[model samples]
Target: DQQVKQNSPSLSVQEGRISILNCDYTNSMFDYFLWYKKYPAEGPTFLISISSIKDKNEDGRFTVFLNKSAKHLSLHIVPSQPGDSAVYFCAASRTMEYGNKLVFGAGTILRVKS
Candidate 1:
């Protein structure tokens, strides 16, 4: 069973506007949530992350919020720019015997239009 899901396949936002990407998880054991951004022909880069102990985390134009009760999370980007257009992946992890293993969503494509 897939642990993470990004229901929306794509989203479009105007430059300088706000873009919201949503994700949901079924595993209550997940202790960490992460969002990654990927450009065309490039690997995904770490963007923002939130721990289960916290509800929100922010970094400049990016923010991540986790709702444990709902098993949902969202990534927000204010003043979205054209360069921000890319695929975003939501991942979750929990501590294991060896280490943490990430369970990733299918990914959502974001288009920031100028």
Candidate 2:
């Protein structure tokens, strides 16, 4: 079965603190990893991504690290802001899938206290 798992359903933190979300995968064939963020009724927006060729990737306030041997990945947000309170989904795919189809986790809801 090709699936990604996010064990935590939610996380809460005060602003200006660090937030970490974890994910695990069962498929060793997966080569592409992504983190998506969503608000209310809106669709997920890509926050950051990494290729299996690399161990880590970073964006402005976000970072994603992939550990191929462990079949795990994580997203880190530093100095978390109130606006970061939302649902975060960890997604992964196999490159052979062609169009980068995503297998998303149930999503972790983050609450950033002001």
Candidate 3:
């Protein structure tokens, strides 16, 4: 079974609107949660992150929320622009014997219309 899941396969929004992406996890051992944005022919770039201890974290137009109790997280983008169109991924990591290993969910493609 997949530890991380993104039920929605895609999302669409108009420019200057809000875009919300949701994710769920089955692992309680995951302490760090992150969101990454990926473009075609490129790797995913780190976006926003939240620790299990924190309920929310924000940076500029991006915000990430974590609900430890529910094992859920969500990423929100405000004033979504056309350039924001890309695949968004949710990742979780836990400190292991060797190092931190990340488990990623299937990405959600976001389409931002101008």
lDDT of each: 0.94, 0.92, 0.93
Answer with 2 or 3, whichever has the higher lDDT: 3
Residue-level lDDT for 104 in candidate 1: 95
Highest lDDT, which number? 1
lDDT, model 3: 0.93
Put down candidate 1 lDDT per residue, 11-100, tens digits, no spaces: 999999999999999999899999999998999998989989999999999999999999999999998999999999999998663255
Question: Per-residue error at 92 for model 3, in Å?
Answer: 0.2
lDDT of 1: 0.94
Provide the lowest-lDDT 10-residue window in model 3: 93-102
Could you estimate the TM-score for every candidate?
Answer: 0.96, 0.95, 0.96
Clashing pairs in 2: none
Residue 6 lDDT in candidate 3: 99
Which segments of model 2 are wrong by more than 4 Å? none
lDDT of 2 by residue, 1-114 (tens): 538999999999999999999999998888899999999989999899999999999888898999998999999999899999999999988877756888899999999999
Which window of 10 residues has the lowest lDDT sum in candidate 1?
94-103
